[model samples]
Target chain A: MSEKIVITGGTGFVGTHLILELLEQSDAELFCLVRAKNTSAEQRLHQQLAEVIQGSDYAPELINQVKKRCHAIEADLQGDITSLATFIPSGVSQFWHCAASLNYEERFAAEIYDINVEGTRKALALARALNVDCLNYVSTAYVAGRNTGVILESPMAEVQSSNVYESSKVEAEQLIYAQQDMKYRIFRPSIVIGHSRTYHAINFSGMYGFLRRLIQFKGMMARVQRGYLERESIRMNVDPDVPINLVPVDKVAKQAVAIARSDSSNTIFHLTNRTVPTVGEALEVLFSTVGLPPPKIVQDTTQYAWIDEKFNEK
Target chain B: MPNEIFVIGTGRCGSTLISNILNHHPDVLSLSEFFTFVTDLGTLIPQAFPAIQINGAQFWQIVSGIYAKQNIMLAHDIAMKEVLYPFKTDVRFNASTGVPAILQTTLPHLTPKYDALFDQIHTVITARGMATAEAHYHALFGWLAAHFGKSIWVERSGGSLRVIERLYQHFPNAKFLHIVRDGRDCALSMQRHNGFKMVLLVFQITEILGIDPYESDDRSWQDDLPDELISFLPESFSGKDFLAYDVPPSLYGHYWSGEIMAGLDVLDRIPAAQQLTLQYESIPNRHPQYH
Candidate 1:
């Protein structure tokens, strides 16, 4: 039988990339679960797909191909669960659960759980209802939380998460692994950024968020205090040594699709970049990106704040 | 004791210093840069309580709804916590932009517990049902004046003089204080200021991406900004290697000239009794607000 794939969050950055990669690699029929309220699901997916492929290696051609082959299954992840079964077609060979709430703010705890945890449960429920062959769960490597040392691609005992979103994903992972009958796979990607080769990233979260804010800040200070740039060095509290695993969108999609295509059932794959960049290096790139003065890394803050810049005139 | 006054002038002038002097006065409550260039102006405030009394809860939410700092940060895709609530180990107090900058510099002592301060102000405002950010400011100023037995309230922030027309719409009977600085000096100062540079870059980057940050819905420019601009944005970037890619001083000069003319026009519209103009050279002569 031909490979019949059903995916959620297919209109998102990673989802779009995964769709394009799958279209190039496989002859499977793809169903993308997109939340379409005002516009049609296909219309929303097309617009998102167009945005994702802009300035990439395959521009119009690949997008057009996916547009023709891909089907937009209308379903809201945070919406009614029973309605999901009605939206998604029956007999889905594999259900790819990629949709998630990435908000890490303290205020978004309820919404985060609603989408990340309950949404995953509903997706898994839909998979079980359809009696799908396997459910591929897209997770984040940050689920490793604040723990140090190298992490192997293996089933981990439920541990504390770095943030609320991470914790929600951990809950979702537990739900999947706890399943007694169904075969499931978990793919955890670390800090997804722009494309590796082209640097074409559709979403502007994570590193982009940090960099964009930093530049705005540097510029603001320079304007508020004309001599802001004249300062010898700027400083942040981020650790100097820990490596931040940043994988490109395309790389994550490529590796993820490769693993999803395998026959192995309950395997966990870490879709991470080989050469991880340090937090110091990341901050360096950020300050440098806007041509602003770099801050000297200081582990001690109280003495410096109270003593060095007495009047906060630094 | 709600004697409203505003210090209007082209940015990069001595407006901050003047605001400082006004702030120190026991009879004056100074609010620096309440309204200026921002993506979200809390537009919902103006029409919110039109000719009606808003309850405390309803009015407080409106005032706290759109933090100008939060808006600017969101516009730049930055998290407010990065600057507003710097981590425990963060030595330097880096409150990045907008009204937050005023608070960061003027009240640096609040840096360690700025969030606590914000929460307190939020609680106080919500308790009384402040209608808008303006209303919240007025309320804060009222409290300040009441605490210090001051009757006059003055707001000063650089470049805010450009938005005098909007201010006039809101505060028609409010007094206007104009501090005129040399246009050339203002331009040079602006060219070096990071905020001015950012505005220049935002304009250019928007032009390159064909999206206006002010009016357009196109945010693709954020991702498409030239690599040269982003070259040294890293924290470990060499301090000595920092080279400013600021727009020409002439552009800033043009901005200053345009703002001065516009600000002057707004001042002219206000009754002569409520308008005061002071030259930069006449600073030693002292001003009415000072005494």
Candidate 2:
């Protein structure tokens, strides 16, 4: 049989894209690990594959082969993971672990570790049990934490994360390193945006948060626009100049699969945009999208302090 | 310690705006979301020596816990699973945390020396023997005032008016500033905010479990509450019909009316001088800045 490969988080945004890229690029039989929350694994797998093909501009022949070769193994990485051993047999050639809990809140620090760290550990364990040849781990560039300046493509050590999610991913990387016996390649991608050229988003996060806020802020100002209610100024605390490295999801998948396919072992690669957009630029687009004025990003709480007060009134 | 002021409102009433104006005075210390923080951390109260008496180390523990649990998680989706690591040297104490968000947003100069200020506050709180959560409140206010050279501190937290009775019981001498907003507008706003949704869910869960949510000693609410409900607490539970009772979006009107009545009910027990009502409509919109 052609080289058999198993992957976790196969139904997520990045995972689905990776599956399609792998299907077209390689002649490999793929066993995808999917989570079944309320639906059966087969149905979720179908939906995940269907969404990709529907969104992509790939040929019908390749897309058809993409659906046929990719098999689904239903499992929850955060749940009783022992059940994972049932569907797949031993000696899988390659294992790509791409699952993560992307929540950044300090309150969710614990859950982030549970899913990102523990889940990675479990995936590694399953890889070992199956005696996999190579393990490809997908991580984030944010594992650099709050550090500024250029981050080298190397193992991050003695770093402090501003939030729990970053810290948890850092811990996951450490956990992987601790298992020195395994041959693994880590792919660290910066903030994954939609398709580079199409701009079609399968999942909305990061930049989406600002866009959604614009819409919500508009709702607050909607009545005022109609002259039914008086307008109120909202005080926000965002620093407009912060730079965000937004990487296209398509590019991330293509590069990640290429790196995984390479002979390099225990190497780290940063898949990021060459020119990143600043927070100021992102906000401009966001405001225009929701038909609102460019937000008065007020850092002076004393002069514009009423902004927070009025904003929170809702 | 100087006198304490409490601003109770259903939110969307611009109490924050009032606090913003008041905070311009060097003598006035605005404790944004102060009571809300206490209420969120009230679970730790039972562990206090006398149901609320926490020492300096314990006080600091609560402070860091607030950063980890409350401040970090205010976004509604934040959940603290197993990583409750103590306050680190590098982590920022900024907008993500409840009270600090106000300071970080308005007064950038106020923070840089935040850690030193917190240490000083911890020393004073720990030095005193707090017998009740009210006692801790008194110490907190005093520490804040003395540290900032402010003689008066006003407590401002949106939606705090829902549990005004706790404030009345704890700080009887405290002045209450009631801000009222148009219920319809507020109701429409509530349906969109994750914070408001979480507040309503907690209230609903407490009602279902038959426990007083505001009371610190009612620990059984956590035990009696379903796992599904508990799971939702860590994340924003969007499903309306999942709970024992379905909370329709329209109920926001009833919620607003109920809170206004509750605030009014609590106002009756206080002296006329101690209670003041500020209608949101009274404030004129002079700013044409909003589009």
* The candidate that achieves the highest DockQ relative to the unseen native structure: 1
Interface RMSD of each: 11.6, 12.0
lDDT of 2 by residue, A166-245 (tens): 88888888887778657988889998887887776666456664454445445433311221112333455568798878
Q: What is the interface RMSD of candidate 2, in Å?
A: 12.0
Residue lDDT tens for model 1, A1-314:
55778888897778888888888888888888889867899898988887777746665688767767798877888876555566656667888899988777656789999999999988888888777889889998878886667777876665667679889988899899989657888999988998888898776577876666555445433433334444545655557788888999998998888887878868899998889889888867767777766667777665354212311221
Poorly placed runs, candidate 1 (over 4 Å): A86-89, A219-223, A226-232, A303-314, B1-291
RMSD in Å for model 1: 15.9
- Whole-model alpha-carbon lDDT for candidate 2: 0.66
- By TM-score, how accurate is candidate 1? 0.56
Root-mean-square deviation of every model: 15.9, 19.0
lDDT of 2 by residue, B47-119 (tens): 2223455655565455434432244343333322111222222365432344332222222224456556655
Clash tally, candidates in order: 24, 8
Write out the backbone clash pairs for model 2. A107-B79, A107-B80, A108-B79, A110-B81, A110-B82, A235-A307, A301-B106, A313-B12
Q: In angstroms, how far off is B54's CA in candidate 1?
A: 35
Task: State the displacement of the C-alpha of residue B100, model 2, in Å, after optimal TM-score superposition.
Answer: 42
How much is the lDDT of residue A79 in candidate 1? 77
CAPRI quality of model 1: incorrect
